[model samples]
Target: MDPKSVRYISECFVQPQYAPEESKQPFYLSPWDLAMFSVHYIQKGLLFTKPPPADEQENFIGGLLDRLKSSLSLTLVHFYPLSGRLSTRKEENPPTYLVFVDCNNSPGAKFIHAALDMTVSDILSPTYVPVVVQSFFDHDRALNHDGHTRPLLSIQVTELIDGVFIGCSLNHAIGDGTSFWNFFKAWSEIFQAHGNEACISQPPVHKRWFPDGYGPIINLPFTHQDEFVIRYEAPQLIERIFHFTSESIAKIKARANSEYNTKKISSFQSLSALVWRSITRVRRLPPETTTSCRLAINNRSRMEPPLSPDYFGNAIQTVRGIATAGELQEHDLGWAAWKLHEAVLNHTDKKVRGFVDEWLQSPFIYQLGQFFDPLSVMMGSSPRFNKYGNEFGLGKAVALRSGYANKFDGKVSSYPGREGGGSIDLEVCLPEASMHALESDGEFMASVSSSN
Candidate 1:
């Protein structure tokens, strides 16, 4: 429960003037972007020390608004596609949509300011981090796959008793996790530099790439025109951030590799296996049922010549590892981890090319493993994304979080733990019943620590 909620103050439109060079233009949506239409926004942010005295707070916030607005516009001059909307042709067999970055017509990103009574710890330290994270977002409209007329990005600033929260909500169709962070990093540089254009390290490359013969995947029996609306019922789910120290991770890796009789087991695979096995056991799923785990893989390096790290678009695809509940229950942790390792190993250049070729032929390939699949779980986001390192004038973030939309059952995202020694923190969301059961499951609780 959000024992306390963020008080909505005021909201305003932050329209960064799209550079004049960029006229009305349409950016193509890659199959990768299309597949991300229904998922939650890539909500990430940093917590900073509270504002100065009231007079200073006003000056601080006003100065921030000015710098953010102008710097963002300058940022958009380079990453213009982000300042536009998704235009769709519903008449097409399987509705086609193109990203529009028309500066004149686009309503630049939305910005809002709000406040809450709780400090950072109030939100970060809970067994299930509270859903109040969403109170910080002005998620203007429903989320959907079709490229509709909606702001491509939204930013929110929230004041706490002793800290500030900067939340960014970017449309999933425009980019993947890497692209999302890249935009933030670039924008932050400009803001911290006091709007110095010279501060931008690498201007983003907004052009999207795809193989020839690319077309939308039509008639996805599953691709109904689904609209994602936010409905808040009393909390029926749990959201918990669990930290596993380097020592624990090392032990898990050792056990996994020893069990596999090889040094091939990776930290990710070992951790995923541990989490999957733990959650599966605590949930007490039927043994005969088959379950799957989905891993979001970045395809940038997998491409033949490799896409530039600066390629700012959705460059990710999901890889799935599956087994029977019986197998997961019966296998040793290493065996379970091996399954995940094998999936990672399967992501070869050839395999990635085949995927791109397949997407070229079929546009609507969505790997939304069964939504809330009782027998399945997924691990997204990379531990490599050091969210806590993102900073403005304020010090490094004391904590970071995903939006409250993360309450979907069986969904988990991993972040690089702030301790900096190859540690891992997981934001795990599961059903209310399963989460309660998880709290009491000794094995699952054995390695989890309260780092926030």
Candidate 2:
């Protein structure tokens, strides 16, 4: 194999002899389950300022692989009574297959571009190995007519543009976005530590324990109670970057507070409200038309004991808020802000937890699909300062954006300090016409640019 060719690995686990009895209902892995599952699928693409001399490139990859082999292990959890059990947590032992690929012949930029087009389904097939290769291309050459530059992951080479893009398409049912990032951060930390003299210990691991008797249940809506539930399809969501100053965000927050007669409004509240209003305007839906927005609120605190960073499972719960399209548009920004904030707060309350626990415990878990449809808009806020400066030691990232989650129709994320000094960078994905309508609205534009 060419030293620079990508390598692929696959691994599998057999069911454990002694396991818990499986439940007779369908079960979904939490966010933590997804994160732990991802640790086994780590693929790092390191871009150098310039490619090393030909003699050194082979040695580099070999060394990296050796390091990885020594540092990782797989664990499996099993639940038995295999048939007709919906709530059964089956065995989840990590597989033994590990595959690698090399695209030394192609430029790194080209390789990454090609990889992006490969979806999760394509990557996980039994026929193809989990690795790929391509050459890196010049950043300027990839720009669209609109002057927006694509975020390319490239490996820099001297004679030719040599870059490597590495990816692992994980199952979404196992975890949410926050859980995914956490795993990536941990992987990065481990990779960096291998090259340094300082020893960095692995993140702590949590046992495979679920809430007591927390099997699947269903809830019902009067009108749709009898309908058979179908799998929800992930909507086509796009990602775009928006630049705003800290000052602009502050001004908007202040205005929101004044309008609502509330003591304060957060930056997230202000921006989300503006986006909500802008979306309604562009959709040309009346203010009174019913629409719902869902915000992903991290539920790390809600567990009886907080989950550790190394816990390696999904640890998020979403909170939903509903309003008429007109209510969001005609009301002052503060009103929307307050409602969004309250929706989040309400989910965290003990009563809410009790309610969710009861609902999940009841026969209603299986029927939840019949009663509630997924939200129209999905918005998330990354931990502010951590996103922009993700310096895997190559200097700060020039751009940061969220990945497209398969389930949401519209998605938005906030990145801090892209425009300098506490300013937030926004990324939104919607129909092109909707975007155009938002750009032309004066109040919407001003609110986004204002810093309270």
Error of 2 at 428 (Å): 1.2
Q: Output the number of the TM-score-best candidate.
A: 1
Write candidate 1's Cα lDDT for 193-268 as tens digits. Answer: 8777668776777666766554332223232354332332324567778888888889889988998899999988
Model 1 scores a C-alpha lDDT of 0.72
Q: Per-residue alpha-carbon lDDT of model 2 for 1-452, expressed as tens digits?
A: 55333333322212222232332223434313322221111112222222346335655434443443222111111111111111212222431211111111111111112213332233223221222312212222121110111111212221213322333222222334454454445434544565332233434343433455642221222223122223333343333456677777788888888999987678777777777766766778766677766676666555556655444344555565678877776688888888877887677547435655554444222222232343345566553435443334334444342222222345665556544677776666665566667667888776555321
RMSD of 2: 12.5
TM-score result, candidate 1:
0.89
* Displacement of the residue 441 alpha carbon in candidate 2, Å: 2.3
Cα TM-score per model? 0.89, 0.60
On the 0 to 100 scale, the lDDT of residue 35 in model 1 is: 61
Task: Return model 1's CA RMSD, one decimal.
Answer: 3.5
Give me the runs in candidate 1 sitting further than 4 Å from their true place: 1-3, 17-23, 51-58, 90-103, 144-147, 213-235, 365-372
